[model samples]
Target: MSVSEIEKYGKINNMYKVFLDIDESSESNVKPMLTNIASKWLELPNGFLASNTMDGDEIYIPNLHMINLVIGN
Candidate 1:
């Protein structure tokens, strides 16, 4: 499905906080795509963090190899 459609109809609930997560390696060159995806999924003007860490000490560990998106309403 298109990004816009996915975002518009994606489910959101207490069990999910995000509908999609696109991981681009620290050296990948897909800023445009990432931006497009992020813009489409995150409709609210809020803060977001995209980071990678070897040590798992935060709520999000993008570098630990865990990949999934939480969708909540």
Candidate 2:
């Protein structure tokens, strides 16, 4: 899903979860791959929401107060 869509409706109990499912034997490559994926997501439009992984998937969710505070000013 696009970052915006994910941000709009991609949370469980107010947190985003991402998972990296590489084999435990391939642990060395996981960090760099995840970092690249994160960078690509950051390049998406309206992609400022914090992102993280759980169990091998990436999740994105809105930052409510941050958005409100920015908009309120």
Candidate 3:
């Protein structure tokens, strides 16, 4: 992972390192999926930090839309 200096502005100013390890077959597709997720409206019913799976290759997102996208639903 490359270290990036924190920028003073933007929604992600507080950096969170997320490691994604989808299947090799899906690896190349993950970025696009993530891009779509970023563009879509997301839900934070459990708050931002509580939204994701903390330790799995599958990303934890509070929004059902993103979760379904990641899980190939």
Candidate 4:
């Protein structure tokens, strides 16, 4: 989802989750990669959330791509 789309649904009590589609990345490697992305982007919905591992997928915190935000990725 784009920044404008996030601004609309990203609420104070809620959040959006951005997941990196990287299969080769280890848990340790993902942290830096995600940080790099965040550093380049200044403004966020509710600011940066947290990096998390869900069902084996590494996801960056403070989401940018939410399913409900847009129709498709």
Candidate 5:
């Protein structure tokens, strides 16, 4: 599904919005990855909500390359 489709789903379900911070060169895998995530959301222990840090505290470490799934209403 397209990003707008995902956004519309989120709006209807009050679920989430996906934000990608990836370079153009890495665009090839974006759609499949998003589809996988959307399909697996309910299987996640924490459901749709998430955070960048485990304890809700900022990580002071610099230059960290991480993929965070933060679902917001």
Candidate 6:
């Protein structure tokens, strides 16, 4: 899948991390599918933080190590 396909429903932060709400019908229910796609497009290591919310499933890619280094955090 192309990054544009994912980005169509995702919010990309300035730090290049991606935040996406789960859509099992459109994508896969498995978290790894989305994380792998996000990681490949965003050029980060493959990983994600998932949460179940009242609204839906939320996936957060935290490339914080790179961001922290860049910002001197």
TM-score of each: 0.18, 0.27, 0.26, 0.24, 0.26, 0.20
Q: For residues 1-73, could you state the per-residue lDDT of candidate 5 as single tens digits?
A: 2343234335445444445455566666654564443322222442232223444433233432222443332
Q: Give candidate 6 misplaced runs (Cα > 4 Å).
A: 5-14, 17-26, 34-73
Candidate 1 lDDT over residue span 1-73, tens digit each: 1232233224633222224433435324343434533332222233333323324323332232221333232
**Candidate 5, after superposition: displacement of residue 58 in Å?**
30
Candidate 4 structure lDDT:
0.36
For every candidate, C-alpha RMSD to the true structure in Å = 12.8, 14.1, 11.9, 11.9, 10.8, 13.9
Taking the tens digit of each residue's C-alpha lDDT, what string does model 4 give over 1-73? 1233323235544654444333443544544545544433222353333223323333343454323211224
Best by TM-score: 2
Off by over 4 Å in 4: 1-25, 40-73
Q: Write the per-residue lDDT of candidate 2 for residues 1-73, one digit (tens) a residue.
A: 1122233326446643332234556655544544534332332242233234323434323352111101111
2 against 4, candidate with superior lDDT: 4
Pairing residues by index, what is the TM-score of model 6? 0.20
Model 3 lDDT per residue over 1-73, tens place: 2223333335544444433345667656654555434443233442222224333333334433223222222
Which residue pairs clash in candidate 2? 18-53, 18-54, 18-57, 19-54, 19-56, 19-57, 20-56
Better of 2 and 6 by lDDT: 6
Candidate 1, residue 4: how far the Cα is off, in Å: 23
Q: lDDT for model 3, please.
A: 0.38
Estimate every model's Cα lDDT from 0 to 1. Answer: 0.32, 0.33, 0.38, 0.36, 0.39, 0.34
